[model samples]
Target: MKTLNTRLDNAIKKLYTAFHNNTLHPECCKQCAVGNILDNSDSWKHFSDEHGSTKLNYVGRVNEAFGKRFNGYTPSELLQIEVTFLKACGYQLPIHYKNTKPDTPTDKDVLFNGLQAVIEFLCKLDNNLNVMDYTKIFDKIKCDFIEKSPVK
Candidate 1:
């Protein structure tokens, strides 16, 4: 079995390799990338308020249950993974906004525009590119180890 560090290094290597060799497929058309997730985010925020306070009062159970210090994946990483699939079917994604400024796109403003682009691109993938399949592979990369120290 590979050590956690080795596994992490390999994962990072793959991410980097994919980055360096990023290949955009032919143009497909506009579609949703994370339309479902965005839609669910609303439902979750609403449900947590009205009937189930589960998500709102996540407190600490979420950490124990999901095994993360906080939210598991970073914005860019998440966006990248979302794009990877739809790109396989020749979809062009909008440049992700990664800034903090209100009026301008920042180097770190990875939200709305990024999400919109991803969704649009995703709406065009071939039926063969199972979203769940790519999701599992991406999840594995993010969840690579059983933390060395649980109480950090």
Candidate 2:
């Protein structure tokens, strides 16, 4: 069994590669955040009927009931992570073209923001700090976790 840190690290690496390679897509199950975390598998999609919905379907409920952990995340957690990613990417839930979506789905900045959101959510699941949050490094005081950059 991999530790939470190890799993999260692996997920980040996978997402990094996908983002740089232009393989990450909000509509593609195999290239999405949860999909990449699960080794590019689309199996996690069965957890919900809608792409950005956190509501579990029958498959999800059964798996959750069995205490199944897909790549160290439960079905509910997977949905949450996907929702976080999609929402950060500027999609209105469930992902329909008629709804809302990024002007360019493959745009680097958009994808980076989505990835960042997912990473934060993943860390939160384990009650851990976001690995990508560098603000902590400039913490003049422990209470100043949200301090602005010293450069400005």
Candidate 3:
């Protein structure tokens, strides 16, 4: 029999792929919960460096309001959440090109690995996860953002 962790991991992978393929929503990223957090945080540089100061400031304010919910998660766990959230929201992980040496993995490769780590962590967090469990987590994340997000 498969372990609960294995089941959850499989479910999250399926959901992540569905989200990535736009089977859920085509424009989900524009209003994504985790995307909003990353777009507003200093860590956004890890994904994209093109944001202007004003946009970054806006992201900062958003983070100020919602960052506390993620206080205990490790950086890697946070990255997983961000990647999962982005995929579920119908967005693509940005392809960073900083370490493309022959032996090193590309940005896409790193992101894929990150996603796998996230699945493992999430699966371990709950032993009785269903496919909708991640969606519930996503909803909570979204609710936190919507509740604390500043006015446009």
Number of the top-ranking candidate, with lDDT as the measure:
2
Put down candidate 2 lDDT per residue, 101-144, tens digits, no spaces: 98898788889999999888887887777887877766656556
Task: Order the numbered candidates by lDDT, best leading.
Answer: 2, 3, 1
Q: What digit string (tens of lDDT, one per residue) describes model 1 on residues 1-152?
A: 12234323333333323324431111111112222233212222222221211233343334335643212232332334345533432334432234122242221222334433443333322212322235677667666754543666
lDDT per model vs. reference: 0.31, 0.86, 0.41
Who wins the TM-score comparison?
2
What's the distance in Å from true for residue 56, model 1? 26
Structural similarity to truth (TM-score) of each candidate: 0.22, 0.85, 0.27
The stretch of ten residues in a row with the least summed lDDT in candidate 1 is 23-32
Residues 1-152, candidate 3: write the lDDT tens digits: 14445434444544365446433221233322233323323444332233111122444445545653333333334445555544433244442345122232223444345344445546555645433346788889999999999989
- Over 4 Å off, model 1: 1-39, 42-71, 95-152
lDDT of 1: 0.31
Q: CA shift at 128, candidate 1, in angstroms?
A: 22
